[model samples]
Target chain A: MKETWKELPIGCIIEEGGTSRKFKTGDWRSERAIFSKEKCTNCLLCYIYCPDDSIIMKNDKVVGIDYDFCKGCGICAKICKAKAIEMKPER
Target chain B: MPMKALTGNEAMAEAMRQINPDVVAAYPITPATEVVQLFANFVADGRVDTEFVAVESEHSALSACIGAAAAGGRVMTSTSSQGLALMHEMLYIAAALRLPIVICGINRSLSAPINIHCDHSDTMGSRESGWMHIFAEESQEAYDSIFQAIKIAERAYLPMIVSTDGFIISHCMQRIDMLEDKEVQDFIGECKPHHSLLLTDKPYTVGPLSLQDYYFEHKRQEIEAMMQVAPIIDEVGKEFGDKFGRHYGLFEEYKLDDADNIIMAAGSAAGTAKVAVDEARDKGIKAGLLRIRVMRPFPYKQIQKVLKDKMIISVLDRSDSMSTMGGPLFIETRAALYDTETHPPICDYIYGLGGREIDVENILSVFEKGEIYKKKGVEKKLAFIGVRE
Candidate 1:
């Protein structure tokens, strides 16, 4: 059962900060970004340009996309001069 | 208590001096300018330790107030007419956030032809904005009600608008007994807030984007809080009365019992109605007045009980809804009496728009018409008192 209004905090105030991680905004995306490793130079442009900051990095090198926070805005793909990030239908 | 001669605006500022909130963010407007201006002086002179922010506009004023209140500070502000209309968006946010910010709301006419005068249009237009309303008839009520408003708003965690008529009360001087600063401070104890943005150990997020999934539940909390404010208002009013010797209730009923004719009104017009009722009574006419002090958690059940079996009833409104039905007070009063056994002819009157002159004789004319209707209740009619039509 869902929590009632009384069970929730007063004044629409959520009692915690940094809750976006748990809420995960990527579910509403109509498109998803796929990392193309062969064409990628790992220049870190996509990492810096991801609108949702969903670009995954291991040791300062881009490894993949964290799809949880990405809403597929295509910002990372557009900003990637290497054409390493591609947007496709989420199916 | 020593009596001090003060205008409605001065009375409000004096109350602010006594409460001395942590923050006051406001933009000045007609009739209400003196309230903030006076408080700014108090801050300048170092009499009170309040952070007075001279905001650019009414919207910014209320936004600053919301920010301060969410940060665990007692906040206040004052505005009128277009200023209030400008702050409409933040009014919903402040109430939705449950910030107990008290406002010295000077009632004035909204601009169409750009008129600056006494009218209920400003506050009445904001009736549905999730704030408590307290209408004052004169300077004394304006002074006394602010102290009670602070307690009530803080207790219920809702915003409050304690309003006085534009120039009618805000400019005119009246003698009102005042409690000393210590007495006033004792009446309203130290401000203890439950939550704050600065409390880093336990963090919180305010004004989050709540969509269809949980927006309905948040609104349900507001609905219950609004309903819960009625008893809090009553208890606070009685406590203020006991401490300050000025008893208050949800509404003031003057000579309601054993009377056949009743005139219902609020704000400054209610004072004129009282004099008219007395004159009518002197001439063997059984006329009474129901002065509604609190308009928000509208005392519907109490009003219904007081108005039962009355033969002639007329509801006076200072502002028109332009709906052709009636003004705000007239609409609510009619609804309150809907299920009562006695179906009294509740006439509707819109008067004093844009500070139009209305006195005892003009009000007596309405009562005299009530005398004729008292013989046998007639069809309910909508009429304008001072407007040339």
Candidate 2:
């Protein structure tokens, strides 16, 4: 037996991207693949080729995603020749 | 604390009894039938309030559990090789629907050449079916993991698959410390459905066929949920360890502190690897064992961290990736450690496949051969342990 930390369920996490509401309701089912900038080739294949249109543009480079809308099909990783894209499980 | 001398199957039933699930659905199959049989006895004796549903097939077993879980009921099931294969369809559905049902899979060889013995192929075959897979090295884990599964599954709302080596852990008698029923009941608590059928008064569909418009989104959500489960499992395992004094994590490390060689394995093979590691250590060889407890979430960070300093890592897989370059687990483990800066050279050995016995001798021999193979680098074929062909 060890110390019991305050266990928070997936649904209870605070949401992001809100000016009015700080702690937004989290979606346990939504996941997005975060790309490692150091490893990325900037091929834009993940950008021009996204099936769900979840991949977005940022600073003239392919970046950012709406995981709530993005289905983790792993298409970007499959197409990334550099293997820069890694699917991170999101809550 | 009343101690019980029980087999793995009996302990599993005791865990179920402690959890006091709403439904217990399973089909009779070799090495696994005893699990459900003991559960049925628990139900008969009125020791636990559960619905013991004897289904006609493994498919029905999982299907019924799926329905029970979706309908806001805590459900559990158990089966083996062919039976797991039989429930393949429902396994996908259970995860897709985000039902928190947990099933016990007695790891056995998939039938083709036809032998009813222990192997990972049975459970390995379902590694990607969107279920959280946890393998037990012995009866303690077999009993304890099931209790943790309900909490883990429900928290993430993802189906959980808990497995152990067939006959080895299932039939072998072990002195297991049964968790107090009140403790288990309190730990598991009540099932809080994210999308319960009983809440039909609100009128929300549970599993609607998503067309091209929404099917992809449904799948994406499922993947996200699975990813969340990794940390949740870690957190819950820590809590359970606090409650029950057993810490079950992504993997258990043995003698890796100074070892240059590490062996990657799952299920009961981890125990065998420990024996070999001890032998090798006694012989002044820096060999260690990494027993994978959680497979689906594939503890990449842990593997990368533990194996980063090792000179060579030998991944022993009980199931072959089958025509792939290396074993399936090897592929996953390599991928998990891919981006890491301090990762070691990893190779794979496919042994104990098809229910073949992997004893202490087999493990030691594998370690010896693994060192030799490590010098040569990744091989085109996996070395077969205890196999003569």
Candidate 3:
């Protein structure tokens, strides 16, 4: 982020796409999602519902959660029908 | 150049035809309808390559202009009174987005009984909307201002409003010296926009949500751009004068040199005031007139330099501020003179509301009052001319 007016873009226009990725929002989370691959139904429900696109997928199968971008909103845990995803307090 | 008798609306339309802008999205309203009506006729006849959008309402009209302008299209629009009032929110949006959209606001009084006439209430109400404003005194100036506005707006990367009194200038016909289409085209050149939405290689968002963290900084940038416009106006005006022979400035000083008493005004009222100034000069009252052509980026230093030595100054405002402090012009003029060393006793006169006629006699009385104020100091801070008690 530009600290001064001289360095700021004209009209504060954002020039680049996905600029939100620069700010690590995952640090804002107090809770983390734990994904169990063995118990998962591979429905990709968590992948589809992750607001931050934090759900990691490989070959259309839910693998894990990318904690770098997640704010731990817990929507994945709430939507998991097979009780595969669990929200855990950060240690 | 060719001289032709044209109404203010026709003059503005002819200017638009000559400039040949990319888009003109406007809705119809009283007093301002003919401007767009005539331009639409030009579009239909294939005289100009303008995409004329006859939107459903004034709100949509401005909204479409915003969209088109953001896409790097040179746009123009016209409206008056309620039409302008409806586009109020979008007015700020257009400026904040920094699109070089040129608008011709036919000034009219606001509602209560809903009157359509010549008044500055519409433009005055939008004084703080972050758009550069220029007022036209007659059809000739109205025609000339359109080209100047295009150059100024594009250069500053800001929106501009070229206003003329509704009905008084919009509907009345006057002889106007028009520039040839090629001359206007070459003078204005092409609309070169900065940070357009249509640039595929460099994708960017416009009018984005800027929270508290960055909104202030964005506003600061806008302020800087607006400040730069004052000098740009003079530069463009000088260049236009060099090529076209008719010069423009922040304000016109009519026999202001060596004058003790002067009346500062804008729009067509200045024309009436000039006649009064001449009448006062004949009687050796040492009276003069200062006609403010550019309102926004208000010529603070220029006004101070012109009126600093004067003994008495009367600011004529066509619309009342309703704050009991006269009107916008009066308030601005007072504020501009606040820091001056002389601090001349300035009075404000509110007149010509709702199409009220202001003849030479009415303006002459104000000049006479200025003479009295120079001798006796100011008796009243605010007074209404040609108004019943």
DockQ of each: 0.77, 0.01, 0.46
User: Model 1: residues >4 Å from true position, as ranges?
Assistant: none
Query: Which is the winner by DockQ between candidate 1 and candidate 2?
Result: 1
Model 2, B277-310: lDDT tens digits are 9998787778888888998888787788888777
Off by over 4 Å in 3: A1-3, A18-40, A45-55, A64-91
Docking class of 1: medium
Model 2: DockQ score: 0.01
Q: How would the candidate models be sorted by lDDT, starting from the highest?
A: 1, 3, 2
lDDT of 3 by residue, B1-389 (tens): 79999999999989999999999999999999999999999999999999999999999999999999988999999999899889999988898888889998899999977899888998988888899999999889989989999999999989999989998899899999989899999999999987777888888777767778888888888888898999999999998999999999999999999888999999999999999999999988999999999999899999998898899999999888888888889898899999899898999998999999999999899888888888889999999888899
* Minimal lDDT window, size 10, model 2 chain B: B202-211
Q: Model 3, range A1-91, lDDT digits (tens) per residue?
A: 5567667777556876557767667888999999998999999888889999999988888889999888889999999999999999988
* lDDT of the structure predicted as candidate 3: 0.90
lDDT of model 1 at position A13:
88
Expressed as tens digits, the lDDT of each residue in B1-389 for candidate 1 is 88889988999999999999999999989989999999999999999999999999999999999999999999999999999999999999999899999999999999997998989999999999999999998889888899999999999999999999998999999997998999989988877665899888989988889999999999999989999998999999999999878988899989989888899999999999998999999999999999999999898989889897888888899999888899999899988899898867798989999999899998999999887877766555788998898
